[model samples]
Target: MTDAPILIRSVEVLSDDWATLKKFTFDYRRRDGTLERQVRQTYDRGHGAVILPYDPERGTVLLVRQFRLPAYVSGHPGPLVEACAGLLDEDDPETCIRREAQEELGYRLRDTESVFHVFMSPGSVTERLMFFIARYSPDDRIGQGGGDRHEGEDIEVLEVSLEGALGMIDEGQIVDGKTIMLLQHLKLKGLMRASAHP
Candidate 1:
């Protein structure tokens, strides 16, 4: 609506349960000076934050495994291995990820580096995810993190070598997008070196 390329006509709420789902009707002006009517439905589950905690000294990283209904329905038969993430209900991105790290991975992060923000699924989902990376050591654990039981989260923490994680991706084990991005980022950035472990 703010740009001249599009004009919003109407927005209708389709569902208001767990998250808000809406149908948007608009007119899009093409580069050829033609107007086209478009209708799209977007699922709004709010934005979220995700963090990958890595130990450069050990050349290892922390991850979690949990059941995802969407992935299950999409033909994955088991729990998904992913980086720590949580929705930003009423907290900022850093605050939300810190809480998620404690609840999901049991690590008290000291310094966190903001990586980037992305729209994981911009086609239909109206959720923006903030990405981060933090250094973690063995001594950062404060509790047995398996997620909040009241939230029906039964997570399993994983500590694997950086190389092993990349192999998992090739083996179709770690298929989550955010997890893949963080792992690849760590590798591409050379944040951890082969000599780091020795």
Candidate 2:
């Protein structure tokens, strides 16, 4: 703890096609004062932002279904249900999520609440995601959102009741990490359920 915990020895580019992938050699200091050399490959796809837009009056939440190659490759038979999210190419977190909400969900975010920033996959992926939640009504929709066609995105928009969304989680229907987190957060906060129950 007294000295630097890690020391980088070398780095090599593994791939740079879509995102940057690099192999790193580093010296890691153990708790017992032993230094060990290790190698790790990291995929750098850049950080991103995700949002869950909820309609309190309707008790429903907006979501999307999209074809994720990685998920498909991992044995999922169909598109994954997920929150609206996008890589923060050049915009800040708030700006990134707002634009993503419009593009992927067709809803204009009026007031978004920042929840947290998390590394969904910290071991091999160097991408952090900012999480958010916001209120949306029927009037906020401004477009037919199916993601960017040029980007090969054919997203399906879904609006489900909050309780139904939770049931989907239990049934293993919604498996995306960010979506699960946001849904659970909303339920835990009792954002809409509290008033309904009382």
Candidate 3:
């Protein structure tokens, strides 16, 4: 068995905010009477959710393409195609995902199920992302959904076949990490089936 490290000292956070800088300090000890100290950094934390809506009969999936500043600044010149995703405010994970779907794609989801929850960048940020999956018919008419103009979101919804979507992943067209993880999960579970439209 390995020896457990001792906490010699620690620092606690009294308050934090979205735009405020924060820091944490920790002190530890080894079995040989040696002391060690480390400082961890954190930033404004947020939550995100990804939704994978599948149409079983059509073998298609709903995806959205949008402009992302992070991607654009990081060298990706083209828009990003990803599953419906958004930040969680004061609502539950499920509710946040449902609302994001409608706002981003104009699609209403039913019988949503949790796929997984992950931390996008735990080492430097406090963003927790929840992933979900739902079944929907592709034939359903989704009104124009481009997010709220006040929020500056202009999203384009796309319905592509499962094979095509997988191809996009292979071609690196779908570069969003959360979307990639959710698609992998669906493929692994063999739940990438199409639903019959009414």
Candidate 4:
């Protein structure tokens, strides 16, 4: 019925090696009958995929655990168990997800499929996240992957059955929003149900 808030102006650029920040000034019209102009703010951050690589035969999925400052500050008990995800650079979402999978989990995802794109924090942060799914096989020889040293990432990869992942979500072990959304999407689509019994 009512119009969404309008962005009158915006300025954005890549800040760090792989980070993009944007400043937005916008105006909104109130319901009663008032024109309110304000300099609202949002970040057009490029968040990559949370790949839930499923093995139809094995009924397994890959998950990752890592410390997140925002989650901690928001009253989460500890670090989060999530899917392999990161920010996209100038590259497309597919490229970003592939790089993150290898860097964070020591897993190479082939035939990556785009699931959907979502806004992680639409209310405040303009972070557009792309979700993807890929198939991968276990490799015992895969070396430790905790992301690049320069990026200061210490990640631990986990191979769990889809049922186990669902349990983690139910127990609140997976606190990341993107991860939750992806899992829910898979559940709703009946993809996880075929292989994973919960």
Question: All candidates' TM-scores?
Answer: 0.96, 0.95, 0.83, 0.81
Q: Which sections of candidate 1 miss by over 4 Å?
A: 1-3, 195-198
Reference-based lDDT, each prediction = 0.94, 0.91, 0.79, 0.74
Clashing pairs in 2: none
Residues 37-93 of candidate 4 have per-residue lDDT tens digits of 676555555555567777656777888888888778888867789888877768788
Candidate 2 wrongly placed segments (more than 4 Å): 194-198
Most TM-score-accurate candidate: 1
Worst ten in a row by lDDT for model 4: 11-20
What TM-score does candidate 3 reach?
0.83
Model 2, 1-198: lDDT tens per residue?
A: 237999999999989988999999999999899999999999999999999999887788999999999899999999999999999999999999999999899889989999999999999999999999999988999998999999999999998888888889999999998999999999999886422311
Q: Which RMSD does model 3 reach against the true structure?
A: 4.2
Worst 10 residues of 1 by lDDT: 189-198
Task: Please list all clashing residue pairs in model 3, or write none if there are none.
Answer: 55-194, 55-195, 56-194, 56-195, 57-194, 57-195
Give the C-alpha miss distance for residue 143 in model 2, angstroms. 1.2
The candidate 2 region of ten consecutive residues with least summed lDDT is: 189-198
Q: Show model 3 residue runs off by greater than 4 Å.
A: 1-20, 29-34, 139-142, 194-198
When sorted by TM-score, best at the front, the candidate numbers are: 1, 2, 3, 4
3 or 4, greater by TM-score: 3
Of 1 and 3, the candidate ranking higher by lDDT? 1
Q: Candidate 3 residues 8-120, lDDT tens each?
A: 24455645664334667756565676767777767655677789898766677888999999899999999999899887888899999889888888888888999788888
